[model samples]
Target: MSAEGEQYGSSEEEDMYSDDGQEMEEDEQGEAPAAQAQPVLGPKEWVGLASMPAATQQALLNALGKLRGRNVNEMTVIFIGKQGVGKSSTVNTLLNERVAPSSPFQPENVRPLLAGRMAAGFTLNVLDTPGLLEGDSVSARGLMALRAALNGRKVDAFVFTDRLDTWRVDNADRAIFTALAENFGAELWERTILGFSHAQTTPTDGKPYEQFVAARVEQYRAAVRSTLGMKNLALPYVLIENGSRCKTNGDGEKVVNDKPWVTDMVSTMVDVASVGEGYEYDHSKAGKKLDPNNKHKIWILPLFLIQVFVLRPLLIGQIKRDVKKAESKAKGKK
Candidate 1:
């Protein structure tokens, strides 16, 4: 087996490569033009707004109001990350409604879900996607599913969710950054907001909470930079605690590290959208498909030519010379 096979497996049905070939072919050929922006028929009312603390509600309204000032009446945000990383819970917390089914023990299905909410003549659409990783590799099936869900819709920003309690970032974490850049485009990163969920955890390293948060943010920023080769990538981050046990401030707003995380998260989303235009899905921007089996096969022709033209001729001449020497020696002896 080749080195890639040993590392990722040779099976055609391997999780990383499964269903990716077709998706990549479609991408390479350029899928249909960006779908027309269809209205989210009969969006649900923002009932959760009334339940939020008055201060948080006003803060959210004020942040979204800035988007209105920019004439962006409708905003769409997508959530993506590894499985069971509180993606759905974050969505629920942000919208203040249980629109996406979430569970700690069981991972959601591979299907993507879109939930739209309307408030004060503004529309907010959130797309919750399946986990992007399967085992140690990026799951092509999950990417394919997310692409289908998007269907060329314009996205204002992306919320990349992960657990803050996890101390280490591994190759799998970096692979996600590469996969996203390859499948969707490097431009997506510019509009992405790093959402560190489970933000209410105590630092086991005995570091100050702010210091620990800063270190964690830098770790992920470095990963994104190294993986995507974007050394200057500026990633805006939001600390999130999706648990019901999260502490509340005097105004009844959920607080993480004494800050109203929900308000800050929403404000950051608005900031991301205001900085750039909405990202419309374009398959043409996708990177060329990588064939794992044929990745390093370019050396095959050169090696083959050496074996047949150079090595074969040398071997044949050597054999004839040896045979003639043997015959001459036998005749002399006779």
Candidate 2:
């Protein structure tokens, strides 16, 4: 998608998909189950039906019928991440217009914001929730609220957001991903894509921007692959900067993201739309407590602090006392 320019938190900007907001639907027993697809007619075709003539709609369906293994109607994408990780910003970039509130301080109280009807034939809907963090109840509740709102509708894809500059995925990110797998079964990774934003920072003063980005991109890829044990599965991710303001130069490229990041983002959504099943929210698996009991979910900074304040000082004092005792014994023998 091409953009004329980019702005943040503009009073003029509005949430075009605000009407898509929905509350969690419960069954007779007050429980929401995993998603089970009813049928698909191809989202792009469905969205374009209203705008096209009756004859055009018939021709499009006829052509779609001839094409085999291309039955994707609508892609339901849910963005789960930290408060200011640019989830709304990424959605705005994808729509090529403001469909979300970009103000860092603004409250996105609406859940599951849907895009305006598309004549382009692609059906894409986005749902965003409050941030999730480990060892934090408020954060966990935010994530659960999002899952609950889906009301057992099958999800086409789940976009896990992180930054290009950061070298690590925090404990909360890991826990949430784990919960997804538990809810949807282990194949969840098959349909998952890691989105890396803030790519404008890749090119530095003296560094070769292309090579620098390539190296960092590989690192992020490796991290995800190792965690999922999908050594052979082609690592899925999007590299782009959606957080910064932009001005389109004479060329179509934005000041922040010059690459066709929006296109790739949407295409990636289409690519993985069929990888997994619609999932149910399992509270038992979500919001894992961050402590030593869960060794796999520990943060590196906490481990380092333990060494500096707990382990390292103890070792140093022990060594000093041993040296003094040895010297006294030698002097007495002499």
Best by TM-score: 1
lDDT of 2 by residue, 206-251 (tens): 6686676667667766755666666764647776577555434343
Compared to the true structure, candidate 2 yields what TM-score?
0.59
Which digits, one per residue and each the tens of the lDDT, describe model 1 over residues 1-334?
A: 0111001112322111111111111233323223332332445677778778899889989999999998788888889999988997887788777666676665475556666778888888777777888778777667765665555577888999998999888988887888788778888898899999999999999999999999999999999998899998889999999888999999988999999999999889998888867787676654343212233478999999999999999999999999999999999999
Worst 10 residues of 2 by lDDT: 8-17
RMSD of 2: 10.2
TM-scores for all candidates? Answer: 0.77, 0.59
Give the top-scoring candidate (lDDT): 1
Query: After aligning candidate 2 to the native by TM-score, how far in Å is the CA of 116 from where it should be?
Result: 5.6
Cα misplacement distance, residue 143 of candidate 2 (Å): 3.2
Candidate 1 residue 311 C-alpha distance from true site, Å: 12
After superposition, the stretches of candidate 2 with alpha carbons farther than 4 Å from their true spots are 1-19, 23-71, 108-112, 134-138, 203-206, 247-258, 274-334
Alpha-carbon shift of residue 95 in model 2 (angstroms): 1.8
